[model samples]
Target: MERKNHIILSILAILLAFSFQESRAESRDSLFFEWYTTTNMEPWKSTMEQMAAERTPDNYNQLFEVVLAWYGYIGYCLGNDKEEEAEQYLETGWKFLDELIEMNPTNAAPHALKSGFYGFEMALARYKALILGPRSVSTLKTAASIDSTNIHYLVEKGNQMYYMPSMLGGDKEIALHHYKHAVELMISDSRYHQRHWFYLNTLVTLGYSYQSTEHIKEARKTYQKIQRIAPNFKWFNEEVWPKFVEKYGTF
Candidate 1:
């Protein structure tokens, strides 16, 4: 009888422990979702760190990927000129992602993120032509090998083709092809698959490509599309419109 009672107690203890663990897991998952949705990256970083402390290396790879996604979000903040906070987040997030990639070389997401990282870094850099040329193409080609269907990859490749110097093999027609392909992929979604910012970027890139190739009417139409979507996005006024007018508007 005593032996049977001991067995019952052990089973109960195991069940209780499992229940506690499940509750903790749910709490962490909820916190992660909340931080992600609200763009509360600092708190999200802390939560990921705590989770990393208890997780094994294999699981930590995925956790680190989530952290890297925040890097992209924080990059958006940087676009808004939130430089100080963005720098801090970018530094930490880049380190975490680098480590994760070093540990797991086969993962497709890190390769994709690297393509984005190099692309953005060069796009915003001072000497963009000299610096961002080869690295961006190489990383993006790797990402393409891993996930060809990814719309961002297609768009980025298209952007490079449209804007890169002749020696770098920039082709305006190829760029338009990729942009159209991206649009096709997103067309079936209930919400435009290219969200507001992405759509804005696409229009700007397309307009510049067309303008570069001396297609003035096409450039005007694309810029008009952006105006319709966001009458006040800063890029529209300062970057796109000015360039469009300088190149194609009635002079």
Candidate 2:
């Protein structure tokens, strides 16, 4: 009877622990959604700090936590023209990312993100562009080759193609193709993409890519699509759409 009781207790303990992890993951997702909708960086920074403090094992949810933290702070720093500050965060992010990659070398997500990190590093130090640029492409190509349907890989490749210098073969057409393909893939898997942080981001990316490529009608349609889904998304509604509508009007 005691042995049976012990086994039952062990099963209960395992379930409780799993529940806790799921709760934490849900909390992180809510916080991330807030950050995305509002563009308020406090929750983003706090989440990164919390993840750093936890130093948790790289389970799927926690791995996403690491990625969110890594991208949030470093992207914020770069956008705010704080390259020096971004370097410190980048180093920390790279450490965590590398550890995750080492532990799960077969995981395509980290490889895709690592490719973006290389781009971010180049952004921080353009002098190293010649060295890191091809690395960024190769890393992403490897990631995509591993999983051709990986939305993250597709999006990262689009970013690389769109942002790389024309001298280095940046083609807006390639960006459009990749972005459109990713969006299509995401829509095909609503369970996978619904409320996924990057779903909205990819749509925004596509909209901007269309604008830059002079696909004015497509750009306008993209904006309308986002508006339909998230009318209250502050970043898109207040900042992105308004600025876009200023030139294009309510289309």
Candidate 3:
């Protein structure tokens, strides 16, 4: 009877531990979602700091979330022209990404993220583009080859093609192809399109690509779709939409 009781207690203990972990995970997700909706960096920064401080092997996935959040924060800072703040986040983000890559060499996402960081660095220091540019492309290629279906890899590749000069083989048509493929892949998976910032950003990029190629009607329609899907996205609502209207008038 004592042996049976001990086994039951062990099972109960395991269940309780799992329940606690699940609760914590939910809390983290809630915090991240709040930050996402508000674009409030303080909450995200604090949450990431707490996660990093409490990190263990059991919470490696949470660490990845922190890294991805940091990447977004870096971009936010850069977009706001806060280069110093962006550089700070870039440094910390690189450390996390490097450790993650070391921990899982087979994971393509980290490689894609590192490639993006290099690209950001080049943007900050255009003089270094000659050196950092090739490295960025190489890392991205490695990531795509590792996981061709990864949405991040496809979006990054599309971004590279969209921004690169035409003389250097950047083709807006090819970029549109990549962006469309990425959208297709994301929409095919319900989990990917629902409240996913990356997917939304890809759509924005696709719209911009259309504008770059002088497809004003397509760009207007694309932006309109994004506004319908994510009306609260600040950049889309405040900046991109207003600029588009100013340039071409509302559709």
Alpha-carbon runs more than 4 Å astray in model 2: 1-9, 58-60, 188-192
Ranking by lDDT: 2, 3, 1
Question: What tens-digit string does per-residue lDDT give for candidate 3 at 1-251?
Answer: 99999999999999999889777766665556546656777877777777777778645576677777787778878887899988887888888888888888787878888888998898789999999999999999899889977777877888888888999988888888788788889888743554566567678888998898898998999899887877777657777899999999996
Q: Which 10 residues in a row give candidate 2 its minimum summed lDDT?
A: 189-198
Clashing pairs in 3: none
**Cα displacement (Å) at residue 55, model 3:** 2.5
List pairs with backbone clashes in candidate 2.
none
Task: Between candidates 1 and 3, name the one with more favorable lDDT.
Answer: 3
Best by TM-score: 2
- Candidates 2 and 3 compared: the better one by lDDT is 2
1-251 per-residue lDDT for model 1 (tens digits): 99999999999999998788666755655554444334455776566556546655656545553554455456656676776666666666677667777777665556656666665565455487466667777877886887776666777778678767767687888888787677667566432333333444555677777777777787788778766656655546776588668866643
In model 1, the runs with Cα more than 4 Å from the true position are 1-89, 96-110, 121-135, 190-195, 242-247
Positional deviation of residue 83's Cα in model 2 after best superposition, in angstroms? 2.3
Best by lDDT: 2
Clashes of each: 0, 0, 0
Error of 1 at 110 (Å): 4.9
Query: How much is the lDDT of residue 34 in candidate 1?
Result: 47
